[model samples]
Target: MITLGHAQAIIAGAIAHAQNAALKPLGIVVLDAGGQLLAFARQDGASFGRFAIAQAKAHGALAMGDDTAVLAERAKGNPVFFGSLVGVFDGGLALSPGGVLVRNGDGAIIGAVGASGDTGPNDADAVRAGIAAAGFATGAAA
Candidate 1:
């Protein structure tokens, strides 16, 4: 499980990382292990749909127990399987780079962070930076 404070730190850390890299404004979402939202943020200039994108990113990663980046790769080869999953999730599932699994020191899954409003890789990097800043780790399958 992820605490509110941890979620807030993740958002802050993600924004800071984006700012440092001069990336586009971002929308960030933090979700607990049960796929519930813990915290969210959208920076100025971020598009209106960023919330949906970010939420889907987190939702898909949590549901599949794999990071969105990996999911993206798998989706590329198995489009129909991933497409069915999206429907199963009521359009909540998204395969993209922004969704990264968060793990505790003991390597247990705590939650996930999803980011948008930049390049896919940048979004993923920002979330990873945020997790590290909040004293957590990033993992592929968690």
Candidate 2:
């Protein structure tokens, strides 16, 4: 059960973290465990289609129950299957490292967050910061 406040905090924290770190402008998305969009933001100067990238990252994490980093590694060994999934998911799956699953204190999954507009590791770091700021723990990278 992710509240509106939680979503806002994630977005704000992600943006602030990116800014403070001097990373490029970012686009971020948050989604409930059911893959429903909760909150999104694209920082000024972000490239076009950032929203889609962010959305795909978040949706991929939520749908597969794995962080995007794990998915990326799996995809490398299973390109054919991953390609099929891309079509099946309507291009809403990204095998990248910026997606992370959100968890409550009890370790139940609550939602996911994804960040774009920087290096993959940096994007992931920003999301981690945001989730932490929102008072949630991150699940294991798997």
Give per-residue CA lDDT, model 2, range 7-50, as digits (tens).
99999999999999999999999999888989998999998788
Task: Give model 2 RMSD, 1 decimal.
Answer: 1.5
Name every residue pair that clashes in candidate 2. Answer: none
lDDT for each of the candidates? Answer: 0.92, 0.90
| Model 2, runs deviating above 4 Å | none
lDDT of 1 by residue, 30-120 (tens): 9999888999999999998999999999888888888899999999999999999989999988788999999888888889889989998
Which structure among the candidates has the greatest lDDT? 1
- Model 1 clash pairs are none
Q: What does candidate 1 score on TM?
A: 0.96
TM-scores vs. true structure, each candidate: 0.96, 0.95
